[model samples]
Target: MNQGQAAAVFEGVYARRLDMIHRFPPGLRALGTRYIEPLFVAIGPYHRHLPRVQEMERMKRVAVHQFMQDTGLDWDALLAAAGVVAAQARALYDIPPAQNQGGDDPAAVQVPEAADQGEPQPHEQGAGQQEQNQDGVGPAAEQALGAGVQEVLAAGHHGIPLPPLPMSNAGFQEMLCIDAFFLLHYISMRDADNVPPSALAHLFYSRRSLIDNDIMLLENQIPFFVLTHLNELHPIFLRPFVAKLATNFHGHKSTRRIPPFQHHGYTPPHLLALLRFCMKEPVPAPPAPDAAGGPQQAPDAGGGPQQAPDVEDGAQAPAPDAGGGAPPALDAAGGPQQAPDVSITFTAIGLEEIGINLNVSDRNRFTDMAIRKRSFGPHLFKDPLLLGRELVLPQLFLGNVSSNYLVNMAAWEVCTAESYVERDTIVCSYIRILAMLMHREDDVHQLRAVHLMEGELTDRETLDLITSLGKHLPMGERYVRMLASIEEYKLVTWFWIAVHKLFYLYFKKIATFFAAIGSLAGVFKAFELVLVKKHQ
Candidate 1:
């Protein structure tokens, strides 16, 4: 590597606190690039040269013109404003020297650095107008900001020498400015009632999924700071846009579950980061089980042979005193709650085969998941009905579009693994958990039966997708913790699982035979009625 090039590589790997935007690592890319690489459009330099995505350049220009018209800013106003933040934006992306397309060219990019990366205005200004530009250029900002058409990149410890952008400095600024426009216009037009007058908005309908997929790709992001900066210049309340997103993906519950995007309270490095935050928002624990049909108590809890609290993974639960402490406790309805004798490795069907049934979670986010105990029927009959413990999973739509978002988000998690603590790999962890549960087509069927999984993807396709995604993810804390939780649960409840297994494997067939006899009797009765009518 040239001295400058090597330095740039150093900056990406070692210089910054965490370089947030990145090219998804090729190691993981081996898993699949269908969604990793842009399929329809390119937002940043990473995939701008793809021939298929090249066609979308005109659309971006169209977005630029529309942005100019909507903001009522002259080209020079837009250029200068966008130019100021360019350098810092550039730093977040690690363009290895070989791919430093903008190598040695001076151009810059950056965005708001504070809450949602903005300071609250004591008073409101005109739409899109900012009283102060927190994004105003600095020594760091100048490092990446190109000198438009006039100035060549001056030699100094200016930020990483600009990649010789396919767009010279001026062209680079134009790309950033217009890319912001594309994202902004897309959001504003996401509303159903907006009824886009032009074909541009109409095009979104036909290509909506592809568009969503493209913008959200880990490699295909524009800095969120740029979005914030542009919003400062041209104000658009994104409430409606986010609301539609909530309604589309989640149910009509609206923004109740979705955290709103604001300028002051939250800041994202880019769109993917924002989405990661949204999807990983912690799901509240289900209300504590009431004593009536509530969960059987554990050794750690007040009551029975249940999972020990905070037990280390793979730890063995001590055997109940052979001397016979009081027998297992009774439920509210006086049903004997069976203590598990032993536990088994689980699949989705295995859980059902034993007793824990899958159920749909209340929220729409994939990360909004939990293992809950809810009373599905009479306490006396809970085991027969599969009513006690439930694995609550959110509905994954699992179409090309959702798949696109998932793979890309997981890709982001994998690529940015070191930048995050183990708990932060929510998406990757969630996907892996699903793969663990779903061992085959029957497992996918179980998810479908409860609406835990949905969309156009077939059962096989769904299993394939989850399997592929889960295979490549490094085990994150969330995944490990979940496994521990399940293991601990099994260690404590083995007796209960044994009882259920016996009844299900043997007694249930007898029960089915009796049920069949009852059905046969009903059929005979109906046939008698028909004979009488014919005689009459």
Candidate 2:
């Protein structure tokens, strides 16, 4: 090869590094292959020609025809526009050329069987024609291409009215356009008044649960740009509607309210990313410096740092910097120190035993959580038990599809080098936290009783799901730090529980003596009332 060609190829390879759609890493796929595989339909070239999913291609053609007829545009016009940028679109997927090529030569192609020609014309016998005939481009594909296009294909570029394209190239681009239109239509018609029901009846009535799940698979996605470009040619209004539909569809009722398209800076790479964006919470900024120029101490959700009262009866006090401090120093040799194993020894039920209340919060995202102390009346010798922690976590809807959706998102975050450890670890951290909390089916039952998890899945299934997620992905540094914080928090919480129990024990005798005094006083008052009645 010439130097110029080699240089151009090298540059192209470098440029494609930032492509959004990616193949699943081998580790992730091994954990659950079905999660990444498309069930009902394939949107991109990655799964386009799979034997199992090819039936949907016929449905796509029918949907495309209906879409064009409804929108008042010709099929050829749409195909021409798609053809103009077909090469660009093809480059977006990671499919190998050999797989797409069925021995079709770009220089020549066949006339469709549906064409009016009775016999094999002399010019139609090229290598491309033989390849197309062998590939069996189906009745639906031929009908979609139409007789005019086939005639142009049979006639060489010299005499043809349109630009030359291989049958495979033409078919793939058509597939992309039709698939994108189907998605757009499905999303836009959710609550539209003017749109006819007949236009989307087939899609709405199909195996919706399976299709909905498939659309969010990482490998099954087409780039958002292609959908947008196709939208421009049909109806421009559907663009924003697509985003709104996506926001409502994936999370359903449980999703956090993300602002409409204009205010948000996030541009989703595909459907899965779109759903992930909807659930994301904006990270709070660092606290600003005070007027004296010292670093400001961040307040907890309760508006101040939580303080634990002094321990009675000579118990150990919790370290003031337990949750916030750096790791202990290494030994004299300056090597890494091996800290003693620290873990949460208590379960959710154990916390409840010490008077801690587990309540589910209204927040839609799982990462939203806060621990606060509940207060009681002052004059009544206050129960130290009231100081027990109230754990508030976001409500999650768990079901059959939840595992697939979550695992793929977590896998995407782990595989992409561009993903930020702190910002993008939301799903990963949430899953890890679940793994830490749920040791068995009983833990799942505890969470469900508090309304923290609401769905059809049983406790055993939930436990299994948590177990699977924890095993597959490597823990990030941020997650490690979070684990340390959780351990410290657990230690502090246990200390308070111990202190509260001790204080209750100490006060029990004084409370019993007071109760006896009150009973005697009541008896004396009743006797006095009886004497007064006799005198009257």
Candidate 3:
């Protein structure tokens, strides 16, 4: 080979060497792939423009690869299989030199440093430094950098370069944020039993650091991490934590056996499911501004700023049938005690047990209960016949009537019934059912509560009942609003309808029996009179 051709071939081989970069640690693999790989390619051709420095970068890659392999990580398999470095080399070589893109200029592009190579050195160059080439430029001299090249270099140094390193998308970012959120959500939550608390704590701290500092990583890779941790977190541990959520949160109300969730009045099943998923997963910290003008931080974790304790003192026991009767009397110590007037504690539990989507049996049971009027009967005001017992009231009503208007109407109907025993059961059950239905990833319960409380008292039956109850019962000032809320749900109408229907049926039965007895007496008297006439 000619001297120049032989020299060019050797330079190319040295410049494309892949030793140094292959020696990174295992933990740095994802980081390297996400940030460093693209950068190597970007500067690869430029290095060739200055052959010696390009060779140095190639050597760095080899060093990184070796460093990584030393960790004994399985990630090495990824590199060997992908041939990512080789592909990058091929890509770089395929692109013609900048000068070659246009007509060839007789003069080479001479950078300024080469001209100053004749000057005396102020200080000795560091070890491994290359001497000035024939062009008179020291290999260590800083090259003129375009803005784009500078960005790529910056990304590399910060561990966020492009190419073989995967980039993040909006969805991926959201998932990361959610993962972080759940990590905190699970840890901050109580009942740490059977959980690897230390592992979770470390994970939260790590994720929090990444979130707080705004570290870059592949968005798609986040799900795997989230699922791994989430699988370890048991759903049972969240129950007591959620129970505490109900007591402190204003809109949340306790249901019977099943727990309460955050309520956003009109949320659908799909939305609630998404919300539950978020609660189960890690919650992400807020995102910050990025150098690229993209979000620098993760999205806000969806929850209230003031999280309540997951447990409470003096908490009443869950009632047998949801909304069985009035709660027991409260003693001076602010605890529930047995009351003579109220036999059983009212619970909202039945509402929680009922499925969001009811089957035919659920519908039949609810319908039969709704029609039954006797308080002592199977589906009435008995302890077992609680508001949410037969079926989830809000869910049932929602299923039967397919509109917002119908839902609101049903809610009003149940709330305004006259029988406090019956009315409260329905109202409370409806509230519990609605909360389960509307458990959004974010707290949306207040909106639903507010809507259920709005509007003027238009229904005469409810208005009259509210007026009557106010006069007879020694209700406090708060009771006015409470009754109004109950009235809005149409509890009064249901109570009166049941009472009137039962009374009407009772009178009809009595009348029919009396008429039959009177006919029998008249027939006996007629027979006696005929016999007397025959004897005379």
**Best-performing candidate as measured by lDDT:** 1
Deviating ranges (above 4 Å) for candidate 2: 1-18, 99-171, 192-195, 236-263, 282-347, 350-357, 370-387, 417-420, 476-482, 490-494, 500-536
TM-score of 2: 0.64
RMSD from true fold, candidate 3: 26.5
* Residue 217 miss distance in model 3 (angstroms): 26
TM-score of 1: 0.67
- Write one digit per residue (lDDT tens) for candidate 2, span 337-366: 333574535467655655456676555654
Of the two candidates 1 and 3, the one with more favorable lDDT, higher being better, is 1
Best candidate (score: TM-score): 1
Q: Write the per-residue lDDT of candidate 3 for residues 356-384, one digit (tens) a residue.
A: 11211222111111211123443443233
How much is the lDDT of residue 76 in candidate 3? Answer: 31
The candidates, ranked best first by lDDT, are 1, 2, 3
| True lDDT of residue 211, candidate 1 | 85
How many angstroms is residue 60 displaced in model 3 relative to the true structure, after the best TM-score fit? 35
Winner by TM-score between candidate 3 and candidate 2: 2
Candidate 3 local lDDT, residue 69 = 33
